[model samples]
Target: MAYGVENALAVCCFMTPEYQESKNCQKELLYADEQNVPIIPCRIRSDWKPSSWLVPELPTKQFAHLAISNKSKSGVLRKTFLIGNTHKELTRKTAHGNTSEWTFFVRPPSSDRDSIETYIKRIRVYLHKTFSPPLVILDRSPFEITRTGWGEFEIRVIIEFQDEWHHEDLEIFWNLTLRDNESYEEVDVEFDSYL
Candidate 1:
């Protein structure tokens, strides 16, 4: 148990009366503290609180509740694609300096579109510093970013949820390219239902 705690990225400590009274659990918690590992306190029982040896080790913070429901659905899978089209000018510009138009899209599954549209508040896309007003915010559907450039750079995309949802903004990255090809990336996200 100590070995497992030492190698773990973060320890999920389930707060319960029995867990606090166990000697082995105390040793594992102490070893994790000594190793400077992050301990995430999870509340299994609503009425349980840290006492005895746990008082000094656990900080006074809102513990995450482990709520399991048989009716709760799994995460939704969404795809983000980047498509680039390059065109060479007939003027005195070189081949490397050809202008390229790129479009970035965030598409949800057809079955989950309604849920995504209801929860998502806005989409923000960050472009290269060279572009005028590098930040673009879209508050409606067809979440996309279109830009014409002469070079390739990394683009940052952030999907913000409604204030009532209490969800962290989803962030994604795409490489803006001048190549005549399309790139796709997918992410799975779980959203809590109000019902």
Candidate 2:
């Protein structure tokens, strides 16, 4: 188990009383932790809670709950969008000591690109007050806002849609960082066909 965990990209542990109490399971989880491997805790029994010792071993207290039952369901449509930021240090610095260029963007999945582009009318980004024009409006695809800054701050983004879509404006907040790194958040939008 240790060898497998070491080689695996991620380990999915089905949490249960039996699995938690096992000495071997404990060792495997510890080993995974030592090696910096990602552990995905899944709760198989609805009534069971992770043991005290097990709680600290997992990355976060939140786990995916899997309730097994006999039921029938139909397919549902889902769309995922990637919202994130990328930043890089610039050789040139501003008078206020700003030294990095950062860009925050919202990218829809390839399959839904056309539909998202057609429905989204514009994007509004609100930056920190220190910026000359704190609010920016983008009226095209590749919704993004790029600027140079020296510190990290929260940015508010609003996605406006065409009137025909009849959808409320989507508001999201992103943390803008001044570093040579990139991060993304996955936003899932589910739609009911009957609606």
lDDT of 1 by residue, 106-173 (tens): 76655653645676789888888887799999888777766666777888888898765556898878
Q: Write the per-residue lDDT of candidate 2 for residues 1-195, one digit (tens) a residue.
A: 767998999888877777789897788888888898887888865667878888777746468886543232332345587888999998898887888988988888666645567657898989899987999998887788788888899989998876544457889998876654888899865432211
Q: Cα deviation of 121 in candidate 1 (Å)?
A: 0.8
RMSD (Å) per prediction: 14.1, 18.7
Stretches > 4 Å off in candidate 1:
1-66, 69-98, 110-116
Residue 138 displacement (Å), model 2:
1.2
Global lDDT of each model? Answer: 0.68, 0.76
How many Å off is the CA of 102 in candidate 1? 1.1
> Where does candidate 1 have its weakest 10-residue lDDT segment?
76-85
Question: Which pairs clash inside model 1?
Answer: none
Error of 2 at 91 (Å): 1.9
TM-score of 1: 0.50
TM-score of 2: 0.55
